[model samples]
Target: MRIVLATTLAVAFAVPAVAAAPARPARLGLCAACHGETGMAQIPGAPNLAGQQLDYLREALRQYRDGRRNVPLMRAAIGPVSEADLDALARWYSAQMPQTQGTP
Candidate 1:
């Protein structure tokens, strides 16, 4: 009886640690829709976000969030993001390799 109870308790604790693992932020998927998996923007007119300055990315998102920036799409896109998520995303993108426009 004691061994059975101990085993059950151990399994109960272990189950939650495996099941309740935190998921990656949702904004990362949103960013990937336009910006490639590597942070390089594949679509024309979309600026490459990879290797951008952290301050620049943060300020850009802030402007969109604050209604200072006039881009409706960007405003809607950034509307629900928390400041911490924005900073983390900015740091991630800024660390990627920058894409060059022309061939040598």
Candidate 2:
């Protein structure tokens, strides 16, 4: 009984702390200028970020940050983003439903 009780208490305390921090909002203010308010793009060249694969987005950001992909504007945009922020942003957009082409 004591073991079960202790285990229950431990699990309860452990889970919430991990769950508490929200990975930025679905609409990020900085991303909004090009990626639109909801991961959709309003800019001419920016691709829609909504519903992209998490791994793909993360890799792209990593590339941009590491200079493997050399689009000057993207490198500039990602320069200030930390690895954690990049992961958060990737998760944020990956969970969104993709907008259909020409739907707007």
Candidate 3:
């Protein structure tokens, strides 16, 4: 009984502390200009990226970087980014909780 109680207490205390500090990509500010800090789109035509699949985000970033996607703004924004930075951006955006309602 004591062991179970102690284990539960440890997890309860530890989890919130870890969750409270959100990990973000270094270039999140750049994305946040169009995509909000929480991954919601701030600009009129920008798409929301929160809760997107990890694979899709990575692939999309790659396509944008490589100019296959063909949006000039996206190409410019992503062109100079390294592979590791792209992956980190993808992971960060994918991990965000998406909005529930249809419109922002």
Candidate 4:
């Protein structure tokens, strides 16, 4: 009986743990299509995102999300992203090491 009670308690505690995995970023594939796998923008006119400030990135995304900034492409690109996804993307991009090439 004691063992059964202990097992039930353990399972109860473990349930929340199993359910608590961090939510994966949505729109990450769209982000990667232009930003590259590491957040370095590969397309011309796409701003480099690697190592950018989190606050700045978040603000920019917010602007795009809210129609404050007027880039149609960017607005469309960022439209579907959630706040948590923006935060996660900003955090992920800010940690990348930026590389620079000579100006063409």
Candidate 5:
């Protein structure tokens, strides 16, 4: 019966891990690809996000997430993020120093 006991323990431990696996940080890799690591986007047509107003940035993300603003790539990028993550990103980007002074 030792084998049965060990199997039961293994499953009991594994269930929590499996349930917790999906709690990863909201994936922002796509944003970096276009928007750059610091929000100074390099890809064509990607807007610079550094030092943007907090409210504006937050609103844009909210719109994209909810389909209120339908920029296909942006919608796709933010598609899986939660509202909390959107706020976090807005705060991060808004805190960046603008590439030029007297901006944002």
Candidate 6:
């Protein structure tokens, strides 16, 4: 009985941790078209997002979503994003390792 109780408790605690792990945003491919999959910018004039402050990334996404930023492409891409998905994107981009040019 004690073993059963312990196992149940362990599973209960483990479940939330598993669920809390960040998921890849559904719109990642769209973002990746401009910003590389690891947050490096692939196109000219696009800013690199990797290693940016978490709060900054999150806020920038929010601004783009709410129309404050005013860039047509960003506004279009961020328009249909849900709050959870936005947060997930921010987390993903912010957690990436940044690559610098001319570095071996």
Ranking by TM-score: 3, 6, 2, 4, 1, 5
Tell me the TM-score of each prediction against the true structure: 0.67, 0.69, 0.78, 0.69, 0.67, 0.74
| CA deviation > 4 Å runs, candidate 4 | 1-24, 102-104
Q: Model 2, residue 53: what's the lDDT?
A: 92
Model 1: which residue pairs collide? Answer: none
lDDT ranking of the models: 3, 6, 2, 4, 1, 5
* Candidate 5, lDDT over the whole model: 0.77
lDDT of each: 0.78, 0.82, 0.88, 0.79, 0.77, 0.88
Candidate 2 clash figure, as a count: 0
Q: How many backbone clashes does candidate 6 have?
A: 0
Candidate 1 per-residue C-alpha lDDT over 6-80 given as tens digits, one digit per residue, 9 for 90 to 100: 999999999987675333445787777778756778687777887888799888888888889989988877776
Q: Global CA lDDT of candidate 1, please?
A: 0.78
Indicate whether candidate 4 or candidate 5 has the larger TM-score.
4
**Superposing every Cα of model 5 onto the true structure, what RMSD results?**
12.5
Top lDDT prediction, candidate number: 3
* Better by lDDT, candidate 4 or 2: 2
Task: List residue ranges in candidate 2 displaced over 4 A.
Answer: 1-22, 25-27, 101-104
Error of 3 at 66 (Å): 0.5
Q: What is the per-residue lDDT of model 5 for residues 1-104, given as tens digits with 9 covering 90 to 100?
A: 99999999999999986664322224556777887667788787888987899899889998999999978888888986788888778877776666752546
- Tens-digit lDDT string for candidate 6 (38-67): 899999999999888889989999999999
Q: Model 1, clash count?
A: 0
State how far residue 37 of model 4 sits from its true place (Å): 2.0
RMSD to the hidden true structure, all candidates? 10.0, 7.2, 3.8, 9.0, 12.5, 6.2
lDDT of 4 at 45: 75
